[model samples]
Target: MSGHLLMGALLTGILAGYGIAIPVGAVGAYLVGLAARERFAVAASAAFGVAVVDGAYALLAVLGGAGLAEPLRPIAVPLGYLSAGALVLLAGLTLLRAVRRYRGPLTVSASSPVRAFLGLLALTAINPATLVYFLALILGRGAEGGGALFVLGALLASASWQLLLVCGGGLLGRALTGARGRLVIAIVSAVLMLVLAVAALTGGSPVG
Candidate 1:
């Protein structure tokens, strides 16, 4: 790829990564919760898990896996609706849990790093929208193999941005350790996730 094209891809990747990562969805909320309950080491592993999934999707997109978009395209509308509904259900559950009387810090089961990694990888892989996003990227860019360097640059940019979000979550978790504080953050984030899920399902105007 030409220097200009590579730079453009890098910038696009950075923007897209931030765009996708910023939304506090199920995974994001879970990450924050994990961080609050565990140390940075655990949180970092979770973050790395997220990054690997994202990078894999980006690579697939750059490799002209636009064909993968077809199967999802036929069902996108229905799936979006279902995703929105699920989000709403999850939000309600979270709210109930937060308000209900409970004791002790939220405890995540102790699992090996590989388990955590696989958990996120599987979660992300099942997300049809992620693959669709990659397909869109491929179509917009014309082919994949032709822009290997640009693709790599974009993937790196995305990975870096996502890793930073994980780090930030770790920091935030440390800062909010009290019971009440954790409760408040969890509730607020759950609400945000609901909003995002609704937006995703409705095909709201693009933010980026």
Candidate 2:
């Protein structure tokens, strides 16, 4: 790849990392909760898990396996709907839990680091938009060569950004360790998730 192309790839990777990571979806919420209950080690592992899945999808896209996009295209609408519904359901459950005055540290019983990793990995992998993003990148460039470098850049960017998020959450968790503070954060997060989920379902976008 030319220097310009490499730079472009790097820049694109950064943007993609920020774009995907900024959304406070289920995974993000879970990360925050995990960090609040556990330590940075768990959160970092989960974040890395997410990055690995995202990187895999990016690679698939760059390799012109955009054909994978085809199978998903048929179910895109349904999956979007389902994802939105699931988000809503999760939000409702969260809201209910909040209202129930459940005051206890968040805990995942008998859950290992590997389970957390796999959970996030599977969650991110199911997101078809990741592939769509890669396909868009490949089509825009009109060439698949040098995609390995591009994928590497994107993966690095994504991993860095995700790790930062986990660290930030961990810090926040440390700062907000009181019971009242945790409750407030949990309530706010649940409310926001509900709103986002509603918007996502009604917006008619394939993946919002």
Candidate 3:
């Protein structure tokens, strides 16, 4: 396969990347919330961090995920459960922190951009279901000579979508500037995360 055939791999990668990310599950919601509450730079870094993880998984899928696919199946669901629990835990913590801040003098509590990036990266990394997803896609398409193209396509695709999310969050942050309003946003964000976690466990999309 060469020429246009290689471009097909890129197209496939783009479609697959969007397919995995478009559902905008727990971690995606968290990213949006983080953006709304914090600086856009921090949120953008976090978005890039998530995209990096997605690209890494895509790379792994194209490289040698086929061998691991069989072994990964048994644990994917269990890890997805753990991922759901993690989302719920994050929701609880988010609501608690928001309440604490709302009661006291308002504080920014802004996370550094680096910390935000690493935080999102680690959170996304724990999602073995994501790995399983890429592996399945690779197995279906049979990534061969176009492995690098696939990775590049996946990386760009996921990054673009995540950045779009950050943009929405940024707009939200601009609109709601009051402490009470921010607190409400946090509560709502927490609720959304909890809801998404339930959906993930109950045969819906996987979440981080």
Candidate number of the best TM-score:
3
Tell me which of candidates 1 and 2 scores higher on TM-score.
Answer: 2
After best superposition, candidate 2 residue 52: deviation in angstroms?
Answer: 1.4
lDDT, residue 155, model 3: 87
| Model 2: CA > 4 A from native | 1-11, 23-26, 88-111, 204-208
Model 3: per-residue lDDT, tens digit, 149-187? 888888898898999998888788779877788788888
lDDT of 3: 0.82
Please estimate how well model 2 matches the true structure, expressed as its whole-model Cα lDDT. Answer: 0.67
How many clashing pairs in candidate 3? 0
Q: Return whichever of 1 and 3 wins on TM-score.
A: 3
lDDT of 2 by residue, 48-81 (tens): 8888877787788876565676787787766667
Candidate 1 regions with alpha-carbon error over 4 angstroms? 1-19, 22-26, 85-102, 105-112, 144-148, 204-208
Relative to the true structure, how large is the alpha-carbon lDDT of every model? 0.62, 0.67, 0.82
Q: lDDT at 37 for candidate 2?
A: 46
Model 3 stretches astray by more than 4 angstroms: 206-208
